[model samples]
Target chain A: MNPLSVVVRTICDIFTWFIGIFGIYIIIHGHMTPGGGFQGGAVVATMMAFLLVSHGGKKTLSFAKPGLYTAMETIGLLVFIGAGLFGITTTFFFNFLAGQGGVFGATVPIGPNSGVLNSAGTISIMNMAVGLEVIGGLSLIILYMFKGIRLFDNAAESGETGHDR
Target chain B: MKKRVLFMIAILVVAGTFWGALDNIHPFGDVPVAPMDDYYIENAQQERSVNNVVTAVVFDYRGFDTLGEAAVLFTAVCSVLALFRKGREGQ
Candidate 1:
């Protein structure tokens, strides 16, 4: 079993929620504000990292395998490109799905000016697509770093030697 | 403890939400019927071959960049193939 206490786990959970929510906010209001897809996605991924660090693979990573991040990033990139290809027929970059307000104006319409789910334009769709890819890709990178550290720690515990004079 | 951190983040999010709501430029707008930029018109006229300004800029104005990117990807793939081939041959 892991050695961390309840206090650490609780603290980590709180931080994770904050960072994740904040990052999403930035991504949504990218055009009107300074933050955008890439920035916000990175912020969101950091939440997962926090979870992994404090709670170990059991709590934060039990839902996934080590290669899950890699698969997510690959699929996310493909999805992003698929969205970009829509520009060919529409208006050179006209977001076919950016109907009005949020991610799902049609699916989750807000009655008048679309809803929060409706994406605004091609850029917004592109923003979201890129955001997912960015989050997946960078999250994997962080995971790799920590995994490497864990490997080194295991080696130290085993009293493995590393000498090359 | 974790509660404090969560509270801090919650505070940040609430503050940010208020900030976003208060300083929104286009709080409400209809479907865009026209181009949002004038550069598209100018570029379309300057480069008349393609009808789509976005395509023209991507494929024409920055064709060289695309070519270089393609070349880099090709080279990386070739190197990876070579590395794998050598290991297989040794066995």
Candidate 2:
């Protein structure tokens, strides 16, 4: 696909980092806020789509490696499963770190108040894991779909020339 | 004429079902009594140490479902990759 106009590309360059930052904020604050991993990851994945539209498939694909995303997807799933497994002595998916007074283990007041980022234990860990998984999954889907389109275009061109030969 | 009549009937069935369902709907902002929801609201923060009860429920209490959901997404990504894989050249 061809790149968009210079104006659109310029705007995309200015705003793409903001989109990524916002998505990471949502993922990081999932346990304390409205949005969580799935939602935030989906928001972050839009960066891939946005780049593909503004910069074109060739540049986007070259810049973003499939291997990196594949690794991210695998690692996220492993971490999520590992988090669940760690609490198996009590019960699967237990909040073992909550109230334990450490990273992601701070206790919040029993009633309504401002949220604590250091709270939420395995929930926060799982949120980050799922967020990573979603970012990799959705971006891979978009990239592969674009590649498929290019393959189809090549096949059509080859078929057209075959008729002349 | 027959196809149009069938389409009209189908639309009426869907609309009637929706209209009937609306009558049973509770008033806005008035939630039905649910012991499970009450338990989560009351205890999630204390147990999970998370201010967001919804997140606590999703990522903690009902985490098995989220695991399944993640697996589903992984499978979908795998399938897309397999389908779009480049064919061997000079084969």
In Å, residue A6's CA in model 2 sits off its true spot by: 1.6
Report the lDDT tens digits of candidate 2 across residue range A53-86: 8887657877898898999899999999999999
TM-score of chain B of each: 0.46, 0.76
Which candidate wins on DockQ? 2
Model 1 agreement with the true structure over B1-91: per-residue lDDT tens digits: 9999999999999999999888975536654555634655454323222233453344334434433443453344335434433233336
Each prediction's RMSD over C-alphas, in Å, is 16.6, 4.9
| TM-score: model 2 vs. ground truth | 0.85
Worst 10 residues of 2 chain A by lDDT: A156-165
How does model 1 fare in lDDT? 0.53
Which residue segments of model 1 deviate by more than 4 Å? A1-5, A56-64, A90-119, A150-165, B1-91
Clashes of 2: 0
Q: Fraction of native contacts in model 1?
A: 0.00
Model 1 C-alpha lDDT per residue in residues A1-165, reported as the tens digit of each score: 132567888888678778888988876655334566667888988876777666664445456454665565556555555655665684434345533434432232222222332334444444465566666666765555555454434544785532311
